[model samples]
Target: MNYKKRVVKNNQMTNKTKNKFTTHNKNKKYEQE
Candidate 1:
């Protein structure tokens, strides 16, 4: 049970990071233009 919770948490954290990274890249492109 605990292991499953940890796995889910890690997945959520990774997803958040991925989203933030994508947004950051978009912002960088706009700033360059």
Candidate 2:
């Protein structure tokens, strides 16, 4: 049960990072335009 909880937490962290990365890319795109 603890392992499952840890995995879920890690997934959430990765998702947050992914969101930040996508937003960063979008900002770069706007700058280029």
Candidate 3:
């Protein structure tokens, strides 16, 4: 479902965007590692 996409976009709208993006990036890194 697009539900997760909606929350992710909504989070990117607030100050939490940076934190969320940072966390997402970190998770991506761990996934690759």
Candidate 4:
């Protein structure tokens, strides 16, 4: 159970990072335009 909890936490962290990366890319494209 503890291991499963840890994996869930890691997944959440990665998801947050992915969202930030996508937003950053979008902003970069906007700036270029």
Candidate 5:
């Protein structure tokens, strides 16, 4: 059970990081345009 919770937490963090990375890339692309 504890391991499952850790996995869930890690997944949440990864999703947040992925979201941030995508937004950053999009902004950079717009700047280039």
Candidate 6:
């Protein structure tokens, strides 16, 4: 049960980072245009 909880936490962290990364890329694109 502890392992499963840890995996879920990690997944959330990765998702948050992925969102930040995507927004950063979008801002870069707008700057280039």
Candidate scoring better on TM-score of 1 and 5: 5
TM-score of 5: 0.93
Each model's lDDT comes to 1.00, 1.00, 0.88, 1.00, 1.00, 1.00
Q: Candidate 3, residues 1-33: lDDT per residue as tens digits? A: 699999888877875878888999999999999
Model 6 lDDT-worst window of ten: 1-10
lDDT tens per residue, model 1, 1-33: 999999999999999999999999999999999
- Tell me the deviation in Å of residue 26 in model 6: 0.3
The per-residue C-alpha lDDT of model 5 at residue 24 equals 100
Rank ordering of all candidates by TM-score, starting from the highest:
2, 4, 6, 5, 1, 3
For every model in order, what is the number of clashing pairs? Answer: 0, 0, 0, 0, 0, 0
Candidate 2 residue pairs that clash: none
> Over the stretch 1-33, how does candidate 5's per-residue lDDT look in tens digits?
999999999999999999999999999999999
lDDT of 2 at 31: 100
Q: Please, what are the lDDT tens digits per residue for candidate 2 over residues 2-25?
A: 999999999999999999999999
Q: Which stretches of candidate 6 lie over 4 Å from their true place?
A: none
